[model samples]
Target: MRSDIVPVLELGAYAAHIPYHMTWAHEQLPYTPEHERFLELECISDILEHLL
Candidate 1:
C-alpha cells in the first residue's frame, strides 16, 4: 500500500487501489545538480512543499 493512502486507511475510510501508468507532476521530485550532497535538504523541501 502507498504511504499516502495509510492515513485514510487508519481512519477506517475506504480507498481503492488504482495503479497509474503515468507520473503526476506533484509526485515527481524536483531535480537538483548536487543530488547526493543535498539529498536530505531536498527531502525536507519536498515535505515543506506538501505541507503548504
Candidate 2:
C-alpha cells in the first residue's frame, strides 16, 4: 500500500487472518475463478484457526 493509503495487512505466527483487498471500478471488472476460490480459502482458514 502507498504511504498515503490505509495499510491492509497482518503478519505474525498464529496470527492468522485474512486481509481485505477489494477494488472498485467504473468499468467492468475481470477476475478468475481461482482467485475467488483462493480468497474463500483464506477466510475459511482464518476462521478455523480463530476457532481452534
Candidate 3:
C-alpha cells in the first residue's frame, strides 16, 4: 500500500491509489513526438466515471 493513502484510511475514509500504465509528459523531460499520440486519450475520464 502507498504511504500517502495510510492517513486517509486511518481517518476511516476511503482511498484508492490507482497506477496508470502510461508515463505522462514531465516538465523535466523533453517533449517527444510520440507523446502527442496520447494527448487526446480519454482513459482518465473513463476511470474517473467509475471511481466517482
lDDT string, candidate 2, 1-52, tens digits = 1221212222211222243465434222253222211223356555664356
How would you encode candidate 1's per-residue C-alpha lDDT over 1-52 as one tens digit per residue?
2344445555665443333557676654444222221212223345454346
lDDT of 2 at 41: 30
> Candidate 3, which ten residues in sequence have the lowest lDDT sum?
31-40
Clashing pairs in 1: none
Candidate 3 or 2, higher lDDT:
3
Please give the CA lDDT of all the candidate structures.
Answer: 0.41, 0.32, 0.41
Candidate 3 local lDDT, 6-52, one digit each (tens): 45555666554444555444422342123211222335565465456
- Candidate 3: misplaced stretches above 4 Å? 20-52
Per-candidate TM-scores read 0.34, 0.20, 0.35
User: Where is model 2 poorest over a 10-residue stretch in terms of lDDT?
Assistant: 1-10
Clashes of each: 0, 0, 0
Clashing pairs in 2: none
Best-to-worst order by TM-score is: 3, 1, 2
